[model samples]
Target: MAAAGSVYEPLPRPCAFSPRSRDLLAISGVDGRIQVWDTRVAALRREYVPSAHLSATCTCLAWAPARGIQEAHQKKRRKSEAVDNDDPYDILTIGTATGDILLYSTVKGELQSKLVSHHRKVNCVRWHQDNGCLYSCSQDKHIVEWNTQTYKVKCKWKGDSVGVSSLCLSPDGKMLLSAGRTIKLWDLQTKEVTRQFTGHSTLVTSLMFMPIRAAADSRSPPETTGLYFLSGSIHDRLISVWQVRTEMKQKSAVLTFTLTASPVSIDLAPSDSKEEPMKLAVVCRDGQMHVFEHVLNGSHKKPLAPTCTVQIATSGGDGDSTPKPVSILSAGFCPDKQSMVLYYGSSMQPLFEKLVLKTDEPHMCLIRDVKKTLTLRKEMTVTKVKTPVVKAADTKVLMPGIPGHSATVTAMTVNSETQEGKRKPGDQEDTIEDRLGAMDIALPKPPTKTILPRADHFSVLLLQGLESCDSNILNKVFLINNETEIKRTVAKLPVHCVVPLVNEITKRLQGHPNGAMFMVRWVKAALVHHAPYLSALPDLGAQLGSLYQFLEMRVKAMQKLSRLNGKLYLLITQIGAFQMAQRTSMQSSKQAKLVYEEESSEDEEPNKEHNASDDNWEEEDEEAEEKEEESEKEEESEGSNEDSEEEMDVDKVNSDVDPGNESEEE
Candidate 1:
């Protein structure tokens, strides 16, 4: 077993490709910036700096589909060939920290409009793939549906206590699912929260609506044959397949299957072959990219486990046979059905590559040399260069996920009956000489100027202070490579340090203040609503109540301290007056006693006065005892005041956590 393992080393680190297989239009984060990448050449095309809400980070991005072809044709008739419908046109909408949703045009790269409706951070935004409607969920605990054409909010549905992390619209746009901890499904037409899914034990990270059949299938029935939704959660490490039950009056759903993986991202394959099962590409935090093939077996009446698996090689080393796991940050299906692209990053720059899958076995066939027959306008055109043609049998097996240009053949086959090359009626004799034998041919001359595709323009909002790099300078830098290399520039942004204030306080206090503490109160009221796990815990309500009480007590104590300070000022004033009066009275009494004693000694005799003092001394003893008790009570009050000062010190320390300053430095 050891020898066999040694022979099959782990996979190598995936090769990075600059020219991506698919278009990446928009990227955003909490640090108010939006980056756009050109898919063709892997370059940064353009940057947009929105003036409003520059401090808020962008959380979600969505694209709205273009209108019909007639409108596109009319626009193209005007000298706007660049604006023609050759490229996909869509409305790009982004959600930000300030709960504002900004919409822009992908064709013109212009900001179309903005919506300032949500009260808190907007977490997710989804545009109806088949309609002009938009759906957004925020930390405000509400999901709003909007008419993209009129820019009006059509309806709103309240979510659970916690903010939503992800949202998915059914393929037909009839239903919408907002998931955080509990998955809440809403009827879009009726604008009501219809059903709640409660199987996941943790926060749901991603939700996707996978079509049961290809979206282009005209024969698919709207009610039964369209799409089913799949939900993936971080805590549960499971992917739950859900389908709306038509038999039920309310269109309730049931979970079909749960996979054992924390799917951080998912993408469906774009194949229309009926025999080909739906493919789900899942990225788990365990540094593994799992490709699951959903098979609907007729006999079993349920979906089978993945039919085939492809483990991505992450680490770059000799262990190529035992595929090293990698944390796949994001993944998407390419427009071409042959490949899928995945994006990954660690502490270093983000890397991108394509994974091609083999759909057919190798076969020996003949490929005609079409280049020899066709001629370009220029005689020395690169497209007209004639290359030798080989019988497909001479070629080798092609593995999926390997680049077409450098693929190595694993196997080969040649037909003995077709060993003699025969020309067809249309085939020319001169062109036949170029086949089956190496011949000296003149190389094609290189063109004087290489024509490159026009750069796609996009806007990037720079974080505050990042503008010191001159929005123009930053734009120039990003646009250098058509925005494809923009991933390298992400390091220039200020690194964000995010720590829950309540968690920090809890750690500092080592479990003091119970639920009613000031820190606990802030978390329950302000942060819990934003947290993903708020709805998952059963004791959240009681915990929040205790936290509120702790906050109330702290507030009351602060108010009492203010009142006590005022009373202390009055006591100090009275003490000053008493001290002044006692000093004056002591001086007067001493002088009077001396005078009396001198007169007594002079007028009578010392012996008679001394005998009378015993009666006066007995009365003085009771007055001295009362004075001593009063001094003891005053000392106790002074000690209590000192204890209050120490408590104040603790309060100041607890309240001085500055998140903004700390994040800025980081």
Candidate 2:
């Protein structure tokens, strides 16, 4: 595994495979570092640090389409100079948490431009192949289009309230698809939403624009046929396919497919020939690859199921040298559509793997069972019988079909077992006699069924506690087990035990308010870990009803307490102000007394010869000291007045604070 400060970190977004070259890949790290990798050699080709600040986290990454760059340069005058430059024409764009879009030159290994417009983190970015324009959506609820040449916002529009989590551009560059809390298709030319898709239960995490085939054998390319797209969500684990056509008379219905895990990325592999079926590649959060075939044609009214599922497990000789499940960060089909590239593993130990798909018929077998079987008749008839010509002793022998003995002869039967046990003439003697003194051939047998204890010890303990209906035991069980252990225990619990556990939690919430928070945590963990089971159960409704009631009561109590706390705070502030005013008054009075004492000491000093001169000075000093004392007394009176007003305010606040009401309710 890589260390903390290593170059490799958990990828903020899956590595972006260059649309131009199959060998090039762009990966953005959580630490704002971007590295372009060459898939052919599995080595880093260039690294670009978009920002030197360590806090800048990368959120999204996209590669400028090769066709876009070519078309962009075709309009420029100095074509030879542009072609001769050392930097590759393809640009790698990376979005950061600071809402800055960085365009980096692949060959030069440096940033080309940093576009800043949005105030929140950028979620998705895409480059228009035909216009060389950049489209970006952010959490700021703004979808801005940028002119690549000027590096400025060309246009902007308001996105969804939940923020656009993903974006897809149509091939014609006239429409844009945005997915967030909902999926909406916008007319880029008109800058307005034309269609809105509903049915997703969670925020959409990914969007892909898939082109519809013009004909089964049409020579036109797949890129030109753009009228469909796919959207997926994290929590729902569903992929919905939608078709867009203004001429269609019927309302477009969404075809939804369920997935084992939430999809993180979706890519389309359009077949070049009719024999090859169109394939959809979906990479899930759990590092699983689900490939669905023949789903894009307009023939089906239902969602197409995945044809195959593949999981990439970590290899040995790494950290612990044990095979473990790797979480896939990103995955996509290669340009050839015959293989896939996968980025998986922990942020600290990120790894890359390539899977070569078997698309040809030779590698795939349709026959599931190849075993051959034979049938035989119950009876057989002999066509001819051969008779042995024996010597004079067999002259009186019966015919070949004659029976020699009765079928019910009472005698011991001897077959292969007896013949095999018989010792041969050349067999050697036994090596030694068997030891019957100490060792016996007959061994003691174990009990058929011993009572073994249950393996889920904590769950068993919790069940016992619930069965006994003891609050203390339940509380002890909860306190001893952490959240992870509790979740594991909940998963191990049988389906029947969940309802009782929930009921117990509800009881605890009602009877023991002090432990309500703990009980709530337990219930939340249980539900999160075993939601599929608990949701299907009908008995859970009653428990959840009581649970919600308790929550509502608690909420009301909290509101009351908050109001009381505010009133008490006001009282405290008022009392503090009063005490401060009194303290200031006391300090002022002490200073005035000290001044008076000093003046009296001067007056009592013995100065007979200079008494006449000192007498005049003493008179002036006494007059000034008397004025200061008068001013200090006035200040004391003002302070006392302020203090009295503050005391009244404090008393008024105290009158409003009613702890008795809260106690009674409790």
Stretches of candidate 2 above 4 Å error? 1-12, 53-55, 67-89, 215-226, 249-253, 272-276, 299-303, 314-322, 346-350, 359-666
Worst lDDT 10-window in candidate 1: 1-10
Q: What is the lDDT of every predicted structure here?
A: 0.53, 0.64
**Best lDDT goes to which candidate?**
2
Question: How well does each candidate superpose onto the true structure, as a TM-score?
Answer: 0.47, 0.50
Q: Could you give candidate 2's per-residue lDDT for residues 1-666 as a string of tens digits? A: 111211112213546776634567777553335666666655555665422421255677888876354324444435544542543446878886567788766644456678999877788899887878999998788899999877889999888876677899886788899986678889888898888887665557688876655667687766555467778875567687777766652344456666767676677886645445677877766556677776455536666667776665434432556555545566678877778876655432345567777634222221111111001111323221222222332232111111211111112334574578778899775544445433456766998999787844887877777656666766778774377887877787766566668767776677666777677778887778778765543223223544655676678899999999999999999999999999999988778554333335554555543565764887777888999999999999999999999999997787579767667878
Model 1 C-alpha lDDT per residue in residues 347-382, reported as the tens digit of each score = 123344566754342211212222231222125322
- lDDT for position 310 in model 1: 45
Q: Model 1, stretches more than 4 Å misplaced?
A: 1-21, 29-31, 68-85, 214-220, 248-261, 270-276, 297-326, 346-349, 358-666
- Distance from true position, residue 431, model 1, in Å? 77
Any idea what lDDT model 2 has? 0.64
**Poorest lDDT segment (10 consecutive residues) of candidate 2:** 368-377
